[model samples]
Target chain A: MSAIYKRELNAYFTSPIAYVVYAVASFFAGLLFVATVLEGDTSDMTYLFRNMTTIIIMMIPILTMKLFSEEKNKKTEQGLLTAPVNLLQIVMGKISAAVTVYALLMVLFIIYALIISFFVTPSWVLIGSNILGLLLFGTTLIAIDTFISSLTESQVIAAILSIGAGLLLTSISMFKNMVDIDFVNDIIDSIEMMGRYENFTLGMVKFSDVIFFLSISVLFIFFTIKVLERRRWN
Target chain B: MIEVKNLVKKYGDKVAVNNVSFTVNEGEILGFLGPNGAGKSTTMNIITGYLSSTSGTVTIDGCEILDDPKGAKSKIGYLPEIPPLYQDMTVKRYLEFVYDLKRVTLPRKEHLAEVCKVTKITDVYGRVIKNLSKGYRQRVGFAQALIGNPPVIILDEPTVGLDPKQIIEMRNLIRGLGKKHTVILSSHVLSEIQAVCDRIVVINNGQLVADESTEEITTNFTGMKRIQLHIDGNDNTVLMTLRDVDGVTRVRKVMRTIDGFTEYIVESKAENDVRKAIFRAMAKVDCPIVMMRNAEVSLEDAFLRITAGETQVNRKGGR
Candidate 1:
């Protein structure tokens, strides 16, 4: 698992995707910080973190687009599958690699928060919770995006489909208002990803919300392994 | 040692491999000879644990591939038809990654250096795989297979796209590897297998047609003796005289030479030495014999005969 993780992490840095993702993510975070905190005359980062959800949702697919798709295209999956390693190890290695890249992006946000601290005092607890929320949210999306990447051999298609899936998961709660049935609305509200994240943005680290994200991530990782295993039989 | 017993692999409705079975004893080089789409790669894939057989088992050293994949896979090294290479990685880094991926316990630096030296890719070790030529990329693929020093090495058409010089080099490398490892090399080229392998298993249309030692296949299929004759006489008289020989089964004119001699191939029964009879018969007809020699039956002819459904030459288990 560590071997695959190290190779995958090195692959991200060796290619231009890592730098491109970092640049685009930092540009958006800086743009949001300047527009929301500087001009709005507010030290509260809740609005900034809240608005960054869309950016995280859109940017994660780029980070994970080539995880398995590139392997399939280049036929390197044969080597990995034939090696003396289990399917779970391969899936975890890729997930860990993408999560490391996502963690680096989050670190840039903490740097932005530190810059905000020079002038006025900001609540570190709020910043901590927001960062934690984004991390969990981003990781769950990463798992889903990685699973999507494993489904196809084309990296462009994987990225596009992953973005579509991420947007649908985050915005599915909006359909609750359109439906008249109370049970349907409650079901949509229960499963929506963004709704569970709202608690963390308000400085509440709910255990149930954390478990939701963790379990979703695990479920998607499991799906990715199953997809790979099924491909062998094909 | 590797034993593939009654291996059968099906891709949906199309049966790619049909009850194919063979084995490679320790320290032996077994050649898998087949035409295109003959289930060579599919069989190799199943044996390597990359694909599951529909209803079969591959036992490597003592572990079945499906039952103990880790144990089975650790004992074998496989090079597929196309070398699985990461284009963005340098050869050195790729080799290192394969080493780590295989969890080799050997001293890293020395083992990699030895593999590079053996495959003669030490010069391109630091270059990115994308920039290297096809031959170099192939050698890099070979280098990765040698990383763990596994006992069983399976190469699927290892010399597919190489030049003649590189093909010779690859064959020599495979021959050298056969000394320490049990090797199974697959190829469509008849002479390549005839020159390199100790035993040959011929597969055609997903069926094992012939399995025997390299020399035995030719001799077994050489049951009908063929003799070539060059006669400097009239074609009809030479043909009739050669046909009149007691042991001559058939006679056909091959070609007319520029030196006023006609070439003909005369086939005889298996136990007949019809050369003397043909000489005496031709002399009686006043047809001067220019040249006469026994036509050597090559592996190419044997392969053509076997794949054409003319012979069944399985020597395994005396069946």
Candidate 2:
């Protein structure tokens, strides 16, 4: 598992995709910081975190689209699957690699917050909680995209499907108004990732919201392993 | 070293390998001979645990592959028909990854050096696999298989895309590996099987058709032996004289005129030596026999006959 992690991390650096993702996400975050913080003349990071969440939704798919799809296209998955390692380890290794990159992007937010401190006092507690929320949200996205990558051999298809799934999960709360039933509305609000993310950005770390993200990531990782294992028989 | 029992693999309703069972002993080179889509690769994939059998079990070194995969897989090294390689990675890093994936407990430095030396990929260690030539990439794949020093090695068409020189080198490497590791190689090339294999197992249409040694498969399939003779006479007289001889089953004129004489081929029934009978018969007819030699059956003929379902009748009739 560690070997896979190291290889994946090295692959990210060797190719231009990782740098491009970092540059694009950071560029968008900086632009959002200027428009949200400077224009409003407020120290609150609520708008910044909300906009960054949308940016990361696009970034995570690019980071994960080629994770398993390239392996299958190159026939390298045969070596990986037939190795002595189990399915869970391989999946975890890949997720951790993507998470590590996501974490690196999250660290850049600290610089943005520090710059905001120059003009007005920024709430370190609120900044810390929002960072935690973004990390958890990115984890779920990465796990889901990893599963999506396994479902096909073409990276383009994986990326498009991941973006579609991410969009649906994030905007699912809007569709709740269209439904008149209370039960359906309640289900959508609970499963809506953006709704769950709103608590952390408001400087309140809800236990239920944290559990939701953790469970969703775990379920998807489990599904990814099942998909890979079922391939051997099919 | 390896045992496969009733291994059947089906992709949906299409059966790929049907009731295929074979065993390889320690320190033996078993060649798998079959044409394309003959389930050679499918069987290799199943034995190596890359694919699951529909209704079968593979036992390697006393451990079942499905039940104890890690234990069984750790004892074998496999090289598929297409070498599974990460083209972007350098040869050194690629091998390092394989060592970790295989979980070798030995000292890494010495083991890698030895594997590279054996596969002759030491020169390309620093180059990326994508930039290397096809032969180098193949050697790198071979080196990856030899990383953990597994006791059993499976190579599927190791020399498929290599030139003649590279093919010979790969054969020598495999031959050297056979001294210590039980080797299972699959190829449709007849001469490769006859040259490198200790025993040959021929598969046709997902079924085992013939299993015997290299020499035995050739001689066992010789239902009727032919003797080619050059006679200094007309074609009809020589053909009629040889046809009247006892034990001569059929006679045909060969499409060649050697030294101003017509060549007639005489086939004998039941593997009998009819040269002396034909000699006396031709002497009586005053048709002088210029030259005579026996035409032996080769492995190529045996492969064609066995795969074509013609060997059954020949097997029942001949000893």
Comparing chain B with the reference, what is the TM-score for each candidate?
A: 0.81, 0.79
Tens-place lDDT digits, model 2, residues A24-119:
998988888888888778888799998887788899999999889988898888788777788898999889999998899887879888888898
Q: Judge candidate 2 at residue B247 and give its lDDT.
A: 92
Q: Isolated chain A: TM-score per model?
A: 0.96, 0.96
Q: What is the lDDT of candidate 1?
A: 0.90
iRMSD, model 1, in Å: 0.8
Give a tens-digit lDDT track for model 1, residues A1-234: 999999999999999888988898889988988999888888888888998889888899998999999899988998998899999999999999999988988887678778778987778888899999999999999999999999999999999999999989988987878979999988887779987798899999999999999999999999999999898787
Candidate 1: list runs displaced more than 4 Å: A180-186, B222-298, B317-319
List, residue by residue over B92-210, the lDDT tens digit for candidate 1: 99999999999999999999999999999999989999999999999999888888999999999999999999999999999999999999999998889978899999888888888
TM-score of chain A of 1: 0.96
Complex DockQ per candidate: 0.65, 0.60
Q: Clashing residue pairs in candidate 2, if any?
A: none
How far residue B55's Cα lies from its native spot in candidate 2, in Å, is 0.6
TM-score of each candidate structure, all chains considered together: 0.89, 0.88
